[model samples]
Target chain A: MERIPILRMGDFLLVTIQVDMHDELAMTLQDDLSDRISKTSARGVLIDISALDMVDSFIGRMIGTISGLSRIMDAQTVVVGMQPAVAITLVELGLTLPGVITALNVERGMSLLRERVQSE
Target chain B: MNVLRSGTQAVRIEQDVVLARQTARKLAVEAGLRLVDQTKLVTAASELARNTVVYGRGGDMDWEILEEERRKGLRLTFRDQGPGIADMKLAMTDGWTSGGGLGLGLTGAKRLVDDFSVESAPGQGTRVMICKWT
Candidate 1:
């Protein structure tokens, strides 16, 4: 089975998406991430999608769901490294990802998560 | 349809949706469409393909590379023989969902393309067609 790696980075869990995501894969990631969050009790989650060429409504909703789920578990979630074309396509797809935080890149995303971790 | 090249793929299985999206992207790129345009077309394809599998109970996704004088475009058509939607108006409305989704699939796909059309009947099937020009 193809699975995305989740690395522990201090109090944060980092997920770097390096391939195109299909429906089942996205669902699997959501399940895996949620379980890991409970086990590690991480303070934050950062998803890097720089390698993703597109973000459809399904993937967009998956991102939103992951962030929402993390928030309910007392973890901050920030998606980063979205390409310009993806950003445009997502907006046009009517997936604003309300309540989900976003950043320019992984570095900025970490700092954003750190701020949340510090405040909490 | 003024199609220069056309092909059809089955959308019965989940993996077929991914192939549909790839076909749309490749056709857009080969047509020399812009990056943003390619992404938009691919995104639209993904939504429609998923709908065909999940809501339409599996269907067919067809693609065509189009040419009209100097204009070049890619067109995709999704058709299914499942229980068709009764209310087209409600279905097209954002946030109106019958499949536990964000209710953005049909409406969102429409926004990502240059030309869009939908046809359905209660007992008959449903068909959605979209075109993106370069």
Candidate 2:
């Protein structure tokens, strides 16, 4: 079974999605991340989607679910590096990805996650 | 309209959905679609392909590159033999899903393309067609 690697950086979890993930992979990541957060007691999660070119409703829902789950688990999630075309397509697709914080890049995403974690 | 290129990809599983997106992106690029157009077409392909696998139980994505009056376009048709949709009006409505999804699959896919249409019945199968012109 293939899986997306979740890197632990201090109090945050960093996930750089570089694959064209299938539905199962997305579900696996959701379960895995929630499990990791509770086990490691992480404070924030930074997901880098810079490599992905498309984000349909399924993937969009997965991101929203992850964000909601993290909030309940006492962690913040900041999605970063969305391509301009993907953003346009996502909005046109009617998925606003509500509740999911976003940033321009990983550096800014990390800072945003840090701030959110500290403010909590 | 003339079909410059055409092929069919099976949409029987989750991985097939990803393959469908990749194929849509390649054909969209070959059709000379711009970046945003390519993304929209690929995103629409992803949504439709997943619907074929999930709601349709299994199907095929038939693709064609069309040329008409020096304009290029990509058309994709997702057909499934599974239990068909009973009500298209309710199915196309946003946030109304029978499978516990966001219910944006049908409606969202429609908004992302230049042309869209669907055909389904209670006992007959469903076929959804979408086209993006360059």
Candidate 3:
């Protein structure tokens, strides 16, 4: 997996994760992100999952959990760029994560997060 | 006419995960559950089936269709004569996964249904029961 930190237009810290949506790796990634978000106290987190073609039940649940943990740590999380098939599979598996937000692209996700941060 | 149809079947699969899911899905539908309820039932069954093959060294799933006061539902029990879970608490915790299982297997399955229970001992084997209402 490749993780890169980027600075957005509105002072939002964007972390992009590029990797296969496997179970073990996804959990590990979540752990790392959660730790980093807690330590940095970032305003928002943007996860770019565009490269992932498929997300099984386990990975989907982890994403949901990560979003919740981020909120607890005082950071909002936005999942960006999910494939259509992966989205369908997650819904079919009956895995509905309540608080996490999704976006069709990274720019939109970052925009939403920026707006959220500004409003809050 | 009987309100509920119940039966038990056992199969041994070396590493066939798809077959296990198919069997569970079929049983859930045949038991007169709604589509959404069937999805939850099958999802839970898939998790147990994978565990049976991966951690249990093989096992069987027992199921029954239940009816009461015009309400219908399905109950499934998965039993395996393999090494049982040593730490039930840790196993149920979020993000605590063994055997490379995503760690959501037990918890997610539990949330999908209306009722859930687990019985296991170190060497006595493990049994998981879950039920979903239609």
User: Which regions of candidate 2 are displaced past 4 Å?
Assistant: none
lDDT digits (tens) for residues A2-116 of candidate 1: 9999999888999999877888999999999999999999999999999998888888989999999999999999999999999998988888889999999989999999988
How far out, in Å, is residue B91 in model 2? 0.9
Give one clash count per candidate, in the order shown: 0, 0, 0
lDDT of each residue in A1-120, candidate 2, tens digit only = 999999999999999999999999999999999999999999999999999999989899999999999999999999999999999999999999988999999999999988877787
| Reference-based lDDT, residue B45, model 2 | 92
- Report residue B65 deviation for candidate 1 (angstroms): 0.6
Q: Give one digit per residue, the lDDT tens place, for model 3 in A36-67.
A: 77666687888787876445465577778888
- TM-scores of the candidates, chain A only: 0.98, 0.99, 0.84
Per-residue lDDT of candidate 3, residues B83-134 (tens digit): 8999999988865778765676787678777889999989988899998776
Please name the candidate that would achieve the greatest DockQ relative to the true structure: 2
| Clash count, candidate 2 | 0
Q: B1-134 in candidate 2: lDDT tens per residue?
A: 99999999999998899999999999999999999999999998998999999999999999999999989999999999989999989998999999978999999999999999999998788999999999
Q: Please give the RMSD to the true structure for each candidate, in Å.
A: 1.2, 0.8, 8.3
Q: Write the per-residue lDDT of candidate 1 for residues B42-100, one digit (tens) a residue.
A: 99999999999999999998888999888899989999998998999999999899988
Best-fitting candidate, scored by TM-score: 2
The TM-score of candidate 2 is 0.98
Residue pairs of candidate 2 with colliding backbone atoms: none
Cα error, residue B108 of model 3, in Å, equals 0.8
